[model samples]
Target: MVQTARVLTIGEFSRLTHLSVRTLRRYHEADLLEPAVVDQATGYRYYGVDQIPVAQVIHRLRELDVPLSDVQRILRTPDPGIRAALVAEHLQRLEGVLDRTRAAVVSLRRLLEPDPAPIHVELRSEPARTVAAVEAVVGSGDVEAWFAGAMAELEAAVGDAVTGPPGGTYDNALFEQERGHALVYLPATAPPRVGRVHPVTLPAAELAVTTHVGEHDGVEITYGALGTWVVQNAMSVAGPVREVYLVGPRDAREPAAWRTEIGWPVFRLT
Candidate 1:
């Protein structure tokens, strides 16, 4: 008769793996890890000693910030080459996220610890311009992918007119409904429509604008600060927010050098 492997209960397995019961439960829900046996009476989970390797792999992948869907795909792949390729792709994504996070931390630190020089809010008039743009209704979760595609389209369309950097505008309804419209554009003489192309005219407006130097993802915090400034200074918003990307990913510049202008149009209190 063949002998079965020893099975450990959830608590026992958690101790062995140094993972919390809650984390193990979440892994089980995500289908990233599963137990070897389950009790029929109480539905308690039991894990085989042999399953530790799989659990460790899942833990490491998650520590690397691999998306759950990608983790499932990587685990399901049987070929060594394919698995390596999948891991490489995930590593690239992780690096990008880490870079963005580091930039945000630096920016936040600067904001919290400012120099003696006072931060000035400037009111400026912006001129309207035609741009080659891609518009999409995107949620916060899906904005990264949508932005990648939109930026790729903008770079391709920009020939001689790439003089100024690219930027985007977000409508207010998006954050409220989890569905927001984003228009990524480059200044252009004529709109190009190879694919996912649209023409948008940014209207002239008087805006209270402040420059932020760091990752675009963390610009929301800066916006909050700016909004507070507007309200305290007796100003009400009049139009959608504009984010002008003075420097971008395509420029191959340092992360600290990336500049974004957060512009909020406003009207003074009566």
Candidate 2:
């Protein structure tokens, strides 16, 4: 008699793949992956020893948090180059998310640390100027990519008039929700059309502004401090917040040389 290959049941496959039975079932139901065999009467699933490698790959990809659709796409492609490209794209996205997370963490750390000098808030009027800008509704996860693209567009349009730093305007509700609209721009004498540009009239108002020196990673601390000052001085926010980039990353690659102004429009409490 000829010897046959061995097949493992779902429980055995789960142990071999280090994946929970529940997860395996989900993968099967999603048609993302299927067992090597299924019993006709008992309705039990079994996997061949040869299926172990595929299961491991699927398990690792899922661990990396790749979307089910992408995983299916990747597995369906037999071309190694195509599969590699898909994985690389996901990795780049993950890195961007990690960078934003690090920025938030740094901001939180600065907020918790002791400050020797009291945060100063000054009221000032800003002049209206043309700006090359890109506006979009972006979530925290998508902000990095949006910033990169917006900055590139601004640079291409400004050629030489981008004297000051790049900055942005944020709506008040952005912090509370997953989606927020941001208008990122480079200050220019005359607005130039790039990817997306529009003539916007920024109204003159009394603004409580504070300068943040160094990387923008911890700049949220400055915003928080400024907000605290506003409340303590009996003032209420009246409009959207504006960030004036006094020194841009393009001007100086050094994070220490970067200067940002966080401005919040406010009205005195009656």
Candidate 3:
């Protein structure tokens, strides 16, 4: 076949593709990409202009840390939608990593504060009541997704019957062992049983309460501070910790305006 597209030597191809000459040789060895033509006498490699786009695509995929096998599959796939879907899956994973990194940065900043603002706490006795709820054994990593789904179901089930702000009790094992029962609900007079939503009786208990402001990512910091205070004081945790959403995403657009009350059931230590 006659060569129609302009051909460039290995050095020129490297410049156009922005790929190192040595890396191009490795791609050839891996069967990822091959030069359009090679000199029989001198063993020199030549690439066609059309291959520049292919090389660029490979470069981009490598930059994203996409596995070599996936990149090869992407390039070989004929369907545009399938190729896009494969890339989207990797992007979703990257987004999860970014979210965790942002949370870590927030935590580190809070921890490194020289003179952090004191966490305010209060002691209160709560009355027992039956509330509309959704309960599940949830993994710590899956809590966010589970909470969103369960809350949607709970809201749909109770609707106008809601009597108080939404709240949840998280058992120690959920955080300590990464999986345990989690109960989320809102106070209601007579909550109907729907799907996973049901009436759960909340037992009355003494609590050490503190409010966590802003987003929930940093709520763990407040938990640490509150736990420290509990140990220093004359109290010990007696049961699952409760969180009452006073002002949240449902009520406001700004995370800065959100308020969550964290209550740890406790009893005075001798």
lDDT of 3 by residue, 33-135 (tens): 9989977767778899899999999999999889999999999999999999999998898887787888789888999999889999999999998999999
TM-score pick, better of 2 and 3:
3
The model with the greater lDDT, 1 or 3, is 3
Badly placed stretches (over 4 Å) of model 1 are 1-78, 96-118
Question: Against the true structure, what is each candidate's TM-score?
Answer: 0.68, 0.72, 0.85
Alpha-carbon RMSD, each predicted model: 5.7, 4.3, 3.0
Clashing pairs in 2: none
Ranking by lDDT: 3, 2, 1
lDDT of 1 by residue, 1-270 (tens): 222357888999999888889999888888878778777667788888988888888889988888889889999999989999999988887788787888678667756875523446888889888888889888978888898888887787777766577888888777667788878888876777767877778889889999876667767767877888899889998877888888766564676687898888988896
lDDT of 2 by residue, 133-181 (tens): 8888889767767888877877777879765777788887677786788
Which model scores highest in TM-score? 3
Q: What is the lDDT of residue 123 in candidate 1?
A: 87
Q: Flag the better candidate by lDDT, 1 or 2.
A: 2
Worst 10 residues of 2 by lDDT: 1-10
Whole-model lDDT values for every prediction: 0.81, 0.82, 0.92
lDDT of predicted model 2: 0.82
Give the Cα error of residue 190 in candidate 2, in Å: 4.0
